[model samples]
Target: MTDSDRERWDARFTGLGPGEPGPPGALVGREHLVPASGRALDLACGRGTVAVWLARRGLEVDAVDVSPVGLAAGRAQAPEVHWIRADLDDGLPVTGPYDVIVCQRFRDPALHPALIGALAPGGLLVISVLSQAGDAGGPFRAPPGELLAAFGGLAVLHHAEGHGEESLVARG
Candidate 1:
């Protein structure tokens, strides 16, 4: 991301108050897929909601985002989860062989390889992003089959592309 992009995200986060933490959209009904104990990573973890939820699920979690304001809000809500402030444009900082990895509502094709590399074998990956399939949207939205093609090596458990959103729940 450019300097302006980082600043924009920081400003947006600063303006919004912390919201409730919750499960990944794809894993809401299939909560059983969440491992009982394992390490997890939440990329672009705005306000650390999903990170906190993972911690509550009994996994050690490392959450990363570029916005310090968002990180602070996450820290306030879940002090137990480690919060790391890093620009993802520089690449992922957390050395992860994590059992679970999540990246929601963020899109950067450049980091796709790194995301896959961060996961351990047989690990679960839950990802969601804006898409153009269901509704005509802006350039940030994923084209059809983007998620499936990106993480195709993984054993796909669930994949959906519609409603201007795309989500995938898969195990590597």
Candidate 2:
């Protein structure tokens, strides 16, 4: 993202309070899919909700976001998580063979390859984004079948595109 775009995100997050602790959206009902021990990366991890949950689940976690304010809140709440301030638009800074990779509420097609490459063999990938499929959202949302086509190589555990959201849980 451009400097202005990142600043916008920072402003947005700054006005909001820290998020409640929680597991990744895709792992809500399927927590068993998460490995008991492994490394995790949370991209665009606003306020570190998912990152903190990963750490609580016994996984070392790296959480990245462009908003320093957001990272600060996360660090205050979950000091165990490694919070990295970075502009994901530049590219993922994490060099990972992470056991789990999560990208939530952030969409950038150009980063897909990097996300896939960061996952370890037999690793899990959890992604969720706004979608146009089930709801009449704007152009930023994904169209039908976008997630499946983008991550077809992985063994899908769950997939849903509707309600203005698209989510996928897969294993690479």
Candidate 3:
């Protein structure tokens, strides 16, 4: 990301106040897929909602984001989750065979492979992002079949792109 991107995100997060914990957007109705106890990674974990939720579910979580302000907000909610401030433009800052990995509202096709590789056998991967398939086209949105094509090797449990959102849940 550019310097402007970091500033933009920092300002955006700085403006936000505290928020309650919430489920990962892609795993909302499919919480059963989440491992009962294991390590998790929440990439681009703005404000740490999903990270905290995963921690509450008994997973050791590492939440990564570029914005320190956002990480601080997340820390307030879930002190147990390890919050790491890093620019994902450099790729995932950590590597692991995690039992669960979540990336929400962030689209970086370059990291798709790394995400899959980070998953342990039988691990769950949940992702949600803006899409252009069923919405107006934009620079940040994924095209139709983007997720499917990138994660084709996984055992896809659910995949959909419409209503301006693309989401996928798969097992690795």
Per-model clash counts, in order, read: 1, 0, 0
Using TM-score, rank the candidates from best to worst: 3, 2, 1
Task: Name the candidate, 1 or 2, with the larger TM-score value.
Answer: 2
Q: Clashing pairs in model 1?
A: 134-163
Cα lDDT tens digits for candidate 1, 1-172: 7778878888988867776889989889988988989999999998888998999889999999988889998998889999998988787798879899999988888888888888989999999999989787898998888999999889999998899999999887
lDDT of 1: 0.89
Q: For residues 53-150, write the lDDT of model 2, one tens digit per residue.
A: 88888999999998898898889888989899998878889898999999998998888888889999999999998998878778689877788888
The regions of model 3 sitting more than 4 angstroms off are: none
Consecutive 10-residue window with the lowest summed lDDT within model 3? 17-26
TM-score of 2: 0.94
